[model samples]
Target: MSDWLDEIHWNSDGLVPAIAQDPTSGRILMMAWMNRESLALTAAEGRAVYWSRSRNRLWRKGEESGHVQRVIELRLDCDADVVVLQVEQLGGIACHTGRESCFYRVLRDGQWATVDPVIKDPQAIYAGGHGHD
Candidate 1:
């Protein structure tokens, strides 16, 4: 297992893409970047942790929204370039836009379309809160 960890092909940015999926439903929830620390934290804590490139810090998924993802399984591709996390999502909506998944937009014939409606209001979920901000 340690050898597998060492074999992960992190790029020059020292980051790799991690895909989060719903374990029960087999639905892909979201995709985020993970550095080595984030990967270690996620594996140790059994929760999804990601490296926030914009903020230049580690972020726990759903920390602000109360939509934490509990990881059930972590998988690496044959090439060890990408990781897939099977998780049990705590919140119904995994997306900041109030959708179940971040992939709310679908590309159709050279256009992007919003296929899924917002499941819940983000403001309502994080009312008077400071997590996302």
Candidate 2:
């Protein structure tokens, strides 16, 4: 029998864009890439797991930080290229920049303006490092 993972149309990099959304508020928390293994792990573990292109490995969401995303639902777009994950953000923070969402910048007069405040200092969240992988 064919596997469910086979249904996805991965890109040339063998990855798809995964969007994490807050189930309660419907706010987009973050966006990351997911490979076959990471998507399987995320489903099996009931948490968010992404493929880190920079690190070239599986990145478990909140592996370092204490802000794990409890996945409530997983949805694939009609094209089978994009995925949307409904999750409960444990620490009320999502962005590596310490904001609730990665979409913290807004266009104003053709300039990017920061709209969301940092919920926690990135220094505090990453522990000696500056950002997430």
Taking every candidate in turn, the Cα RMSD to the unseen true structure, in Å, is: 2.0, 1.0
Where does candidate 2 stray beyond 4 Å? none
Candidate 1 runs further than 4 Å off: 1-3, 128-133
Sequence-dependent TM-score of model 1? 0.90
Candidate 2 lowest-lDDT run of ten: 124-133
lDDT for 15 in candidate 2 is 100
Give the TM-scores of the predictions, in the order they appear.
Answer: 0.90, 0.96
Scored against the true structure, residue 128 in model 1 reaches a CA lDDT of 70
Clashing pairs in 1: none
Q: Point to the candidate with the largest TM-score.
A: 2
Q: Least accurate stretch of 10 residues (summed lDDT) in model 1?
A: 124-133
Number of the predicted model whose lDDT against the real structure is largest: 2
Q: CA lDDT of 89 in candidate 2? A: 91
